[model samples]
Target: MDNSKLPINQIIARINDAAEMAREIISEANIFEAIIEGFNEAEGTNLKLTDITNLEAAQDWIDEFLEKYSDV
Candidate 1:
């Protein structure tokens, strides 16, 4: 089947739509990273928040938790 049978304007519209969707997905990923980073930085500074019984494992735990919860 030849796509040329369709109007050029319609093909352009579909391409533009896909591009817009990609941009939106990228934007959402950025926002999610910002949220996770903000939480990590804020918690890192607070002695009480950062002070876990297992201090050696706390940072890893926090990072893993944030990464898990930060979803699209």
Candidate 2:
């Protein structure tokens, strides 16, 4: 799939789907922490999961992260 060509909502949905899969295989907390780490690395900002208040905030982070790291 050419994810970079997808719309923002589709990218977010794919991220959510991957997170869900990770949750089923691992712990949700672990997956969330990993997400936070990826976000921090990709965005060059330190952000813990607790710093995100809602889905919108998380999506914003995901959007920026994808802008930089989608090819990964």
Candidate 3:
């Protein structure tokens, strides 16, 4: 698809939409991890976590989760 034909406002709007989607995905991943940890704790079992691609990816998720609560 040739996006150059679109207006500048349309391009900016698309960028914003993509960013919002990325933020939501990061937030959801963080929430999922928390829920899994809580369930494991409640069951009195060891919770093993797999490594992400790198530290940056992990930090992104943590940041988004913290932003949701305004506390980190």
The candidate that achieves the highest lDDT relative to the unseen native structure? 2
Q: What ranking of all candidate models by lDDT puts the best one first? A: 2, 3, 1
Clashes of each: 0, 0, 0
- On the 0 to 100 scale, the lDDT of residue 48 in model 2 is 83
Candidate 1 least-lDDT 10 residues: 46-55
lDDT tens readout by residue for model 3, 1-72: 689999999999999999999999899878767854754565576544464456687677557645654442
lDDT of 1 by residue, 1-72 (tens): 466888999888888999999999899656655655666675674334424567457658667767876672
Model 1 RMSD, rounded to 1 decimal: 10.6
Give the winner by TM-score. Answer: 3
Predicted candidate 2 versus true structure: per-residue lDDT over 12-61, tens digit per residue? 99999999998786686677778789877866898887787897877786
Each candidate structure's TM-score, on Cα atoms with residue i matched to residue i, is 0.52, 0.45, 0.57
Q: Residue 65: error of model 1 in Å? A: 11
Query: Which window of 10 residues has the lowest lDDT sum in candidate 2?
Result: 23-32
